[model samples]
Target: MKKVRIFLVLAITSLIAFTSCNQSKPVKTIENLKAGIIGETTASKKYEAFAQKAKEEGHDAIAMLFSAASNAEAVHAANHTKVLESLGEKMDDFTPEFEVKTTAENLQAAIEGESYEVATMYPQFLADAKAEKVQKAEQSFTWALDTEKKHNDFYSNALSALNAESESGLPTGYAVCPVCGNTYDMANVDDKCAFCMTDKSKFINFD
Candidate 1:
């Protein structure tokens, strides 16, 4: 009878352990969501500053691009904030740190920042969100991650064109998806945002 009781106790303990391991949702935390929100807020403001500088420098096309990108970042920031709020996470007011440089230098900085998001930051955040089983956060992070990759390519190409001293004509139109903040040159437009399927007609046009 003693041995049987001991065996039953072990079985119950194992069952409890297994059940705990199979939790439907990840452990609740909003650190990553907060960080993402802060990052997006900073990027939005910095890109707007960069847009103004680009316009002052007579890079109208680049200025428009930056402006559109800034709007997109704002959208991402808003999304992150909503998610954080939904999770009952309150973000304290904080100022973001960034430097505004000449258009060329700013482009380089943008490239580096976007590259970091694509290569390091977003990937880790996405993994964490996944591990935590926060599907909304995961989706948001994925959108930002994919969007950052596009921004990196855009900045890199623009920098190369600037360095080449070639006449890189400005696009006829620039559009940003209101839903996802995806920017498009619109020189040769896509029917819709590849990431979010937002209709092209619904995009915010930047002059």
Candidate 2:
């Protein structure tokens, strides 16, 4: 009788542990929802700054497209902010620094930033939406992906035009990786520091 009672106790304890492991956390809380909204808003502001700079530099076409994108981003951010506010959570301000030396540099930075966001950040956002069962979040991410793709194409065309007009008829001051012997094309190259993978500053920049 003693042995049987001990066995029963162990069985109950094991069952409880298994049940706890199988249970999933609650879905679609205000905290996570607010985070998603804030991220999108931050991205919108970054693009807005980039668009303004491009206009200052006379890249009118690129500037116009980016300006349109900024509007779209603002709409997305505001929608999310409204939802979060209804839940009694205040959205944080989002402002990002813009750093591009020239018109070409701005285009390159915009393309690289967009590509990274689409490939890396958007996927994670989609996964979170799926986990939370938030259909709106998924839709928002889809739209962002499409917009980034268009931005990529626009930058590609602009770079080609710039390359064609240079006096030497070639890209200026661009260096090649001695190890990879790859010509630096700012629009497409990985931002990884090729040598040590520490900082992009380590990589040689070709004008």
Candidate 3:
């Protein structure tokens, strides 16, 4: 009987230890979530400043798109903050980057930087959120992806317009399908380039 008691006690103790060890630390509090949202908000603001600079530098369309994207980011940030608040957390104030020079070089750099974040970092973030099963995060990520895709299209179109307006007038005569790389003058342009037909908006003014 004594041996049985000792064995049962040992088993209980082991179970307690195992349970304690396996218990997850509380999920990060919502305050931490707010901080993350603030960070993204800051980034979006930076993009907005970049866009403003681009506009000043004659990239009007790009600037407009960037501004729209910035607003989108702000919406996302607000949503995150709201979620955190719902969880009873206070958010910290965020100050975004503001240094911007209205020069072609600066504009190009800003566009490229934003592109990298959207194309690379954002996608990875989405994947991570999916792995973690954060439904809200996934939704936010999808919104961001869609916005970035639009931004990409805007930038491409703006660049094309800029090039066309440059000293060398739109390359004369040779017809180039904006939808597809397929080059054929007015005579061609059947239905639409297979790739471009998928989404006509993605087509830049190639000719």
State the local distance difference test value for candidate 3.
0.54
The digit string of per-residue lDDT tens for model 3 on 1-207 reads 999999999999999999998864214434335544765587578767877676567655555545555555665576666656655556766566556664445446556755875678667766766665666655555555555554455455556666566623222222222322322222333455433342433333322
Ranking by lDDT: 1, 2, 3
User: For candidate 1, what is the lDDT?
Assistant: 0.82
Query: What value does the lDDT take at residue 166 in candidate 3?
Result: 60
Question: Worst ten-residue run, lDDT, model 3?
Answer: 167-176
TM-score of 3: 0.54
C-alpha RMSD of each candidate structure in angstroms: 4.8, 14.0, 10.2
Question: lDDT of each prediction vs. the true structure?
Answer: 0.82, 0.58, 0.54
Residues 1-207, model 1: lDDT tens digits: 999999999999999999998755444337877888889999999999999998898877778778888898898888888878877667889998899989999999999889888999889888888878788888788888877887787777777767776536556457888888888877755798887898799988987
The order of the candidates by TM-score, greatest first, is: 1, 2, 3
Candidate 2, residue 189: Cα displacement in angstroms equals 31
lDDT of 3 at 112: 77
TM-score per candidate: 0.83, 0.55, 0.54
lDDT of 1 at 103: 91
